[model samples]
Target: MALLGGIKEVPANQNSVEADELARFAVNEHNKKENALLEFSKVVKVKEQVVSGTMYHITLEASDGGQKKVYEAKIWVKFAWVLMS
Candidate 1:
């Protein structure tokens, strides 16, 4: 319990490497299952694609107390382009 929110973000782009790092961090913290699901660890990666413009990806990982105890998901940050342009 309470052994979360300490994982550092990967200094990379919107690629699979960042996603895996996020999963590892979440799994390490998920080992402790006493705390509630309120607190978790996440990684944010920002990338500038010449073809697609600028984008930000946020990956959140949490523990669910199941066979696949650890889970991570990502969402694209849409406002980065607006701010950049």
Candidate 2:
């Protein structure tokens, strides 16, 4: 999957795509059962910035029951270059 705008782009693999869809469906269903006021929940925006080296700072915007919320997450990615002899 290619990272775009911070929201990890959906994986190209069919199985991964299916799994993501299923997870979203499950969450929606669970919300419906737990709270009648929540109509739906979805991601609104995503931003990513490099902190240092392979570390990154990610910000996520989302809405739940019409209320907006922001969340922060940190991640580290490693890149390797191989030399063939």
**lDDT (tens digit, per residue) of candidate 1 on 1-85:** 2223323344555465646554554455545564544344444443222223323233454435422233344333333444553
RMSD of each: 13.2, 9.7
Give me the runs in candidate 2 sitting further than 4 Å from their true place: 1-53
Poorly placed runs, candidate 1 (over 4 Å) = 1-13, 33-66, 69-85
Error of 2 at 19 (Å): 21
Model 1 lowest lDDT segment of ten: 47-56
Q: List clashing residue pairs in candidate 1.
A: none
lDDT of each: 0.42, 0.43
lDDT of 2 by residue, 6-73 (tens): 43433234344434343345445546787643332333333333333344333334356678655443
